[model samples]
Every structure is written in structure tokens, then in C-alpha cells.
Target: MNPAREENPTLLDGFRDGYSVHLDKFDGPLDLLLHLIRKNEVDICDIPIADITRQYLDYIKLMKVLNLDVAGDFLLMASTLLHIKSRMLLPPDDEEESEEEEGDPRAELVRRLLEYQQYKEAGMVIGARALLGREVFTRACPDPALSAARTEEGPLEVSLFELVDAFRALLARIPKESFHDVAPGDSLNIADCINEILSLLQDRDTLQFDELIKDELTSERVIVTFLALLELCRLKLIRIFQNGEYGAIWFIPAVAPEQAGSAGEAVQSPV
Candidate 1:
């Protein structure tokens, strides 16, 4: 009742929750009711109408006293709870009516609560899915010319993973040991592999991926070839394709003379 408190009213004027509360904080009537039910630790299906109704009205009174903007939805729910409580207090007109046949006054309210809870959970699930979608993103291919050319020619039917899987299958057939004398620290350089692949691709418009490496069965050579293919694809120098799923992959050369010339120039420069 303090005059100063009335001048600057708040929903938490007399409430003790260690923080301020406001009418806008609640989503709607059902949301507020659910909060009260949880606070009292009462079952939603078997709501204590008398106690809840009292608490509901107390908050309404507080809102009025504080001059807070109380939505019509809050008043509506208050009336509904009061009506259900009054019906429970009254006796049935016919004592002959069996308990099974008699409808419970709380049935409608329970149904609404259950329905709201279900939708609330569904909304959360949908929101979570949207959040996950935000975490994943696909970017357009960096080279516009290559992308345009590929589209004009035909879409690359095989994904990068599918091509890698095919290469892996081929690699498994090769023996671990090399045919010639073993060198302790010999390894194929990616640059050399790339140059070799480009040279072969220049001679032909398309080549079967397996045939490119068929002459070399060593694991090192196969891995280097696979890496070279990936590099070429990244550079837009070549594209891998297949007619169908699990089909033989073809390495189709991308017609990029300017880009290829630049790459060759860079590699040829004295390091």
C-alpha cells in the first residue's frame, strides 16, 4: 500500500522470487497455470481447483493493485477454474447415476492441458531441428566456369566419397610388399603425382579412373594417384563421374586452359 511503490509498480512488488516478474513473461493462461501447478507439486490431471483458483485470483488481484496490464486470457482461465470448482462442490441431481456414466468436471481442462503440453514439446523439437540445420551449410563450387561447364556437359553423377570408396576397394587388392627392391624412406610427392595425372588427362578427354592406376599396384602409388585426383577436382582441372551408383568412375578433364597454364607456370618456377 506504500504510495511510492504504487508510483512504480511491478508484478514482483510483493512477491519473493529473488528476481522481478512480469505478466509478459508468461506465454499465456495455460503457461501460467502450469507454472502454478508445478509450484504446488499437484498433478495436472487431478488439479486442486480450490487451491489453484485461490492462487490464481491472488495473482490477478496483485496485478490489478499494481496496475499491471492483465490480458483477457488470464481472466478467462480464472473463470473456468472457478466454474469447475463450483461444479465439484454441488451434488448430482440423480443419485441413481453410476460413477462410470458420470462425467468428471476436470475432463475438459485435463484434455486442454495434455494437448498444450504435447504441442509445446513438438515446438521444442522443431526448434531444435532448425538449430541443427543452421550448423550445417553447403557452399557453391568455387569455380563458376567449371560448374557451368559441368552443368552444360552433364552433372557429375558420383560424389567424392563414392569415388574414394572405389579407389579404396581397388587398393585392397594390391599386395603390401613392392615387386622391386625396397627403399627405406621413399615416398611419392603429391606435386609429381598431380603433374603425371594432368599429362595423362591432356592426351585424352576422358579416362577410366581404375585404368589410370591399373599399371601401378603398389599402395603408395595408388594413394598418390587418389590424392592427385582429389587435388585436380579441387582445382577444377578434372571432374569424376559415373553413369549409375556403384558404377565404374570416369575422370573427365575440365577444359580450363588459362587455369591449367597458370598452375603449370607456378610449378615450373624456380623454388
Candidate 2:
């Protein structure tokens, strides 16, 4: 069989360009803003533009610092937020103030968010209904032999933003290190890092995200390894899970039988 790199040349190109973290599947900038709004427990219609903008920019900055690929849409949202913020700072005329909610700087954004939220929730309901059978039918009694493999329930699903938040917290607790480019070496390339992670996963069911990069003190190395973890997620060869809302995050090898069957075989990772 062809190596993963052969199957995913664009992913390899991403590596050469120093961007290996794929964020597209995690939703877009608007979704992120919604997440932030919900996180802060603030009213969506009355978003604190300045505070949310700062937090959003901070996330973007962290992604850059970690070498995670940031799409242009995120930057565009940042600018939009700034524009709204600037407009709000200006004193309003009686005519403008008398205007309906439409006159509010956040009016349009609030409308979009409310609409998008409804659509998202409706979509989730449909998706859950559609997959209900898969959830129920797939839970048939397991073989006595494979019973030891407790992954039948599968790993706890995690989101990209959660991973980012976890990484940010991880960085805060660690000692400061001078960030630099991670030179590709005999033992430090992403492909090797991927294999290292797979090897570690093989010994146990799950690994703490901290355990993967604890030895790699440099920011670049940690970033690259984290990207490797993201790559594994992209490939569906592993799963990232958090214990609870603010619990420890961990990684587990593929939960599917087909993927687990290949645990004994070499994985073809992007070179």
C-alpha cells in the first residue's frame, strides 16, 4: 500500500511550509466567536466586542505561535470585530440612537449568530436522529476475546478549540523557552514524531497530551509534536479526549476495529 504521504501529498506540502495543523474541520471564525460568547456566559445579542475581540486575537496569536495553520477567514472576523468596536466607541446622534436595533453596531452580527445558531442546532438534531441507529445497532454484544478492548464505547470526542485551550493552559504552566524553528533531524521530523506517538499509544490505551511533549522543552518541538497529534486526528488514526469540562486531555489509538487491527502494522504517515 502507498504511504500516507503518497495518498496525501498536500498534507506533506503543508509540512514543508511549516503549517501542519488543519483547522478547517473544526468550523470557522464565526463558530469560534460563538464558542467564546457561550464560554463567557454573556448575552449573544449584546456581545462585549472589545473583550471578545481581544480573546479571539489571543487565540489567533497562540495558533501562530504553535505553527497551527490559521485561515484568512479568522483574520477577516478579527477586522470585522475591530470595525464594530470602533463604530461603537463613537458618540451617537439622537437620530442614530433613536434608530431601531438595526442601528446597534452589533445588530447584524447578532442576527447572523442567532440564525447560525438555530441552523447549527437543527442540524445537530437531524444528525443525531440519522445516526441513532448506528449508535444503537452497533452496540450488539461483543466477542469474548475482544471484550478486553474496552474501546467499544469509543473515545470521548473533543473539539479543536478545546485542544487549543488545553495547549494554551499547558504552555502557561511550563517554563518559558525561546521559540525557534524546529530543524528536521534524524529523530525530530513530524513523521518520526507521529510514529513516536503511535508507539507510545501502543503501550497503553491513552496518553496525556503533556506526556507527549514533556521531554521536548523547546516551543518549536512541542508545536511540531502537537501538529503530529493533529495529523493523527486528521487521519482518524487516533482520538483526543478530555475527562470533563476542565479535565485532563488524553490521546487514544483508533477506536474502530479496522484501525485497531492495524496496531501490529506500520503506519504510513506523511513524510
Candidate 3:
């Protein structure tokens, strides 16, 4: 935690101790524009260029003040906004020239924003569906032992973001110029990685997040192992959890005798 943020709870509690992300967490220039539009409740098709541009510039200034690196795309968007604003101020040569030279300066921007908004909304819907799918569980006759275990461990599921963050932090610790046997056709497949994870859990009930990928010296292997971990969690073959906030995650085999027996019976039964 930064000493400057000690007094600000909101800064401390929000988004990983208010770690400044790419473009202050907005996906890109269009995303920032969309945010300003929605926040001001301004019509996207009829955006007030002067007002929105001012707000966008203000955000960029704040980013600079906070020492957050502003990407080239953001600056490019700023220039576009300024150009459009300048075009709006010029006098029209004639009705034809007016139509051709400065016809609705924001038309292209509006179209892009609309298309991006639709895809963003659709992504939200798909993400919600995925969450619902992960939440689905089989209800069996109550068992005191299982109930106790559930009570002891709050939830078996961890957010996918945390897993990605853990992977990134671990990856950062590796040397940038480390030697590797990464040849043209030497990439590790996710299936092989999955089998390896299962093999490890055979002897031990759980393994640390780093333990699984410690041997993956190359980026390709690390990525495949991460994907394999995600696939295992998606299939309910393993459970990821942490002891406390910002604690190391552990991947534990999700198989139980009851589940194994049920799986065996299902396989033996007629299709």
C-alpha cells in the first residue's frame, strides 16, 4: 500500500489498492468517451463536443498528475476530438460544401460507440451465463461431514481475475532474457498440462499456485499450464481457494468418494 493512500479508504479498498491500470481501467479512448457520455446522460448520437472533450481532457490531465502512463491511443483520440471541434467552427462555402466538408462531425464516432456498446453488453450477458453455469451444483441427501466442510471453507470458487493476476505477478519475477527451448513446434498443449495437474493431485490433495507452473520455464508452458488450471476448475475437477485476503491460492482436487462412485455408475449404465 502506498503511504499517500493510507488516509483514503476508498482508494485502498477499490480495485487492488487502487492500483492504476491501463487508461485508468477504461478499455480505450472510445471506452472513456462512452463513460463520459453515459455519466453526463448525454445522447450518444448528439454528443456535445465541447463539453465531452473538456471532460475527456480533464481525465487525461488527472492521469498525468497521478503519474499514470497515457497510451498513444488516448492522445490520438484527443487530437481527433480537437479536429472535429475545429471543423465545426469553420464557415461553409455552400450548401453542397457544408454537406461534404462537415456533415455531422461526430457521425463516425457515434457509430463506433454504438457498435462497441452492443458488443460490451453482449459480453456481459455471456459472462453472466458463465457465472450461472459455474454455480450449478447437484443436490444430494444432506451429510453432516460435507456440511461441516462447507461451513469451514466459505467458498471453493475464486474469481478468474485473481488467477490471472497471480499468474502475471509470478511471470514478472522470471528473467526477461531467460533461455528456453521454445522451437517452432514445441508448444505444450492444454490437454497434456491437464493430465500433469491430475498426476500431481494424485499424491497430494492440494498444490500451491506457483508449484504447478514452477517447472514451466518457458512462456508457452506457463500459459498452457494456466489455461489447464482454468479448464480443470471449469470442469469441477479442482477447487481454488485462499486462506486470507491476498493469500496464496491452492488448487485442490475436487473429487470425493461420492462423486467418484456416481461417475462410475453413470459410465457403467446404458447411454
Q: Model 2, 1-271: lDDT tens per residue?
A: 4364444343343544576655434477888888889978999988999888877886676567667789998999999999999989887767866765457889898888899889888889888773433443345533332333335575446789989888777667666544444555655667778877777776788899888888766666677787888878887888888765566788877765455546424445344
Better of 2 and 3 by TM-score: 3
Residue 6, model 1: lDDT of: 57
> What is the Cα-based TM-score of model 1?
0.41
lDDT of 3 at 245: 47
lDDT of 3 by residue, 67-90 (tens): 778999999999999988887787
Q: Candidate 2, after superposition: displacement of residue 23 in Å?
A: 45
Each prediction's TM-score versus the true structure: 0.41, 0.39, 0.42
**Regions of candidate 1 where Cα sits further than 4 Å from its true position:** 1-24, 65-67, 95-101, 132-134, 140-271
lDDT value for model 1:
0.72
lDDT by candidate, in order shown: 0.72, 0.73, 0.72
In model 1, how large is the Cα lDDT of residue 58? 67
lDDT of 3: 0.72
What is the C-alpha lDDT profile of model 1 across 27-141, one tens digit per residue? 7888778877888899998999988887777677767766878899999999999899988888854654463535678889888988888888788898777332255433664
Off by over 4 Å in 3: 1-24, 93-102, 131-133, 136-271
